[model samples]
Target: MKNLKALLAVPAAFGAVLAVSGNAVAAESLVEENLVESVAVESVAVEAADTVEAADVMVAEPIQLAQVTSVSELSDVRASDWAFTALQRLVEEYGCLEGYPDRTFRGNRAMTRYEFAAGLNACLDVVIQLIGGGDLTDVRRLQEEFAAELATIRGRTDLLEADVAELEANQFSTTTKLRGQVDAHLVVPFGEADGEVPLLDDDGNQATDPDGTPLTTRDTLEEADATFEYRARLNFDTSFTGEDRLRLRLQASDSASSLVNAGGLASQSGRRNGFEDNIGLDDVYYSFPIGNRISGIIAANSIVTDDFVTSTIVPYDGPAVADVSGPVFYDQFAGGNFGAGVNFAFTDNLVLDLGYSSEASNVNTDDGGIFEEYSYIAQLNFLTDGLFNAAVTYIDGESDELDTPDYTIAGLLNLDFGRVEVGGHYAYSPSDDGDQDSYGLGVTVPDLFGAGNQLGLYGTILPDDEDEPLVVEAYYQLGLNEYFSITPAVIYADNDSGDDSENIYGALRATFNF
Candidate 1:
């Protein structure tokens, strides 16, 4: 059957090839025939401008003729070239190229309008191709569909093309001038659980509790204590001169109601609170280029880290046996206060970041009050085929409760393939006698459903001491379209305590970006 199909395709393929060749030859012949002829057409004569040179030339006719004629009529003919006419028209139509004066229009000198419309058109042509427009045929088809518009600019196609080129020249600066992104998600949990269990995933999915039990919306375990299951993140960044920049990041999440009992560990939410209220930062900072290879950041209140940050879509901290500065422990290390730092890029692929944080006792709350700690943080980051990062931080001074830990260390590594990403992190708090370790693996399949959408899978696991607890969670995102996605996830927790308790929770989420 395969051989028959191959044999049958041979004639059709050959015939198609021959037809394409014929079309190509026909096109080449037509193009040659349609070439603009350089015929000695009648010129649009004009009187010489009133100038002293005209008088001198009139008097020294022999000298003037010798000078002008030696330059050949063709060379002098440049004074009447079509390019000059196009430029003159451009000035008359668009005013002075934005930042120039009328007197600045130098027609006598050879100029490259390639930075104008011509350049813009060429760059756009490339962009349209990169964005999956296929090939030149697609562009021609679009032009054909908009034939009237194409026809209107046909006479000045070269100028129009240069316009795109000009835009392209500015595209880098323009895109770098100021940029912003918004990430928001609304997830609904639909798993069945008898009571509140620890959600295996900390990412805001209202899954089961740490104990092996299911959580539901109904009355059985409705009043369990937990942060809201919904999470939202918004960030904006602006870069000036492609170097110095400013950034503002915000994380917000809704509260969850769930109960969990692991060993002697138990948490019951008196009321549901958002993730932001529990473990996130609301910060703004300004970054300025310090030297040729260094930048400085001035932040009053910010979230600063030395490691590659994973998504807050989950509720658990990263896996670092000794996470000294983790949210679960510090809750607000370099956050909820003021701080500053410097980042140095020793090489194109290596970076060193150091920052100092001081608290004026602003983050005052019942959980942790007026933390009057001084945080010193440093991190060394390297990137080659993938990324390797290590960070160390020390907290001096005392919590309002006078229980500030001395130091924390964290390490992380990430390997990214075209569509797959795998990463792990470890955090340790030698002073507090607490440690955390976490790892995650995820993959994104592109163009699902033939709609240029994507499908993604993410899973992570975190395990602590014998009675400390273990968590596992997984999710799948099905792209509904270019700007929308539907994600469903599950979280499971097993409490190895006397009850050998387990809990499960599930969520269905929708996300949109602009």
Candidate 2:
């Protein structure tokens, strides 16, 4: 062992030299690198040899000796302590100091000279490694070699630490998760059709006044240029219980639809576009499970009609599809409103759902109307989530213009073939004046263009025997990235206003999700 006195002589003398020269003081900064050898040799025979002994040194168990990564692990090393930074440096940066069995330094307790000397020896070893091979000349060599590079690295590390601190200080909600979607549509429609008095597929009666004659108009639809607009929705989803979700969706839409391309007179557009740009909070709902099989949802401002077991059996209803979604009058009951619904699972694959909604409930009778618009619906669903699925739906609809409830029964089904999926829905809509039937059929070729790419052909028939409202929509959807996609589609409508004239429409739909 080199004498402790000798090990200390070089560092003490070098410190004196650094003290005299500003450059040396700055250059001798990293003790871990420049003084490593001398620090290790300091446990030699003199300065600490008589003060500390091997038996007095701390011998920690394997668990207690775990490499300390956090300051919290040292029970007695409070941040408020005057020497806390030094303590942390010695424990973490140098890894030269170890705590007692209780994982604490016990700073308030007294210690023997031998214990103090042992700890000092620990620190000297770290210093020896820091100064490089226990030789002061190594410190000078390192200073000359990487002074600028180390300084730059240190500066960047400090900046990063500050950024993290700032971010943690001014953050948003802890319990709420934010999600959003945006859809932009470029629509070009061509055609103007003369309006006509229409009949139904079932030799149905016509819409008429109190008299026996039908009501008819000869209005002509006006043609326009390509229009571009967008719909955006921001959702804040919060969960009080792990199984329950509260969703608040803020939405904006300004685009309006023509009677032709936007599904003609069909209630549900087979060519589903996205939301129009009406900027406001559009949907607020809470869904919770009562048991493993029962689920429920309630809306405060807006809701989806087919919110439970009866999802609108159309692929275009999804964000992945370019077409507009949801049944127009059916989902909103003619307007966005408050509603409640429940779903009961009969088996793993079968579910039953019921709901009631009304837009006029929020309005005052004196101001506008109360109970003016409402619908109560029930649906039975059977699913395999693979080859076949079906739903039978019944809706009792009422409005200020209607004398009684309009009864409608809708059946929707989806079937899958190896690489193709086929789905359709048929609704028997009967009113006091007439009986109508609306139907849709679609075939989707998955991976036809590429993996996750789809080519879909869809058609909708709005029951009007005279001026049959028929729409055929075809689209190729391709995803460019995880959160973005583009779809180019064409729509052909046989009648825009129950007239003989036909119109063709083109659309480019782009969607982004966050």
Worst 10 residues of 2 by lDDT: 17-26
Q: Model 1, 346: alpha-carbon shift in Å?
A: 1.3
TM-scores for all predictions: 0.47, 0.58
The regions of model 1 sitting more than 4 angstroms off are 1-151, 154-242, 248-253, 256-281, 302-334, 361-371, 386-405, 417-419, 432-466, 478-482, 499-501
lDDT tens per residue, model 2, 80-132? 99767765655555555555545566566555433444555555655566555
Worst 10 residues of 1 by lDDT: 62-71
Shift of residue 306 alpha carbon in model 2, Å? 2.1
Q: What's the true lDDT of residue 101 in model 1? A: 16
Cα RMSD to the true fold for all candidates: 19.3, 14.6
Over 351-425, each residue of candidate 1 has an lDDT whose tens digit, in order, gives 777766555535563434333545566666665544333333333333332223445555555554545444444
Model 2 stretches with alpha carbons more than 4 Å out? 1-170, 194-223, 257-261, 264-277, 308-310, 319-336, 362-373, 402-405, 463-466, 496-498
Among the numbered candidates, top TM-score falls to: 2
lDDT of each: 0.41, 0.59
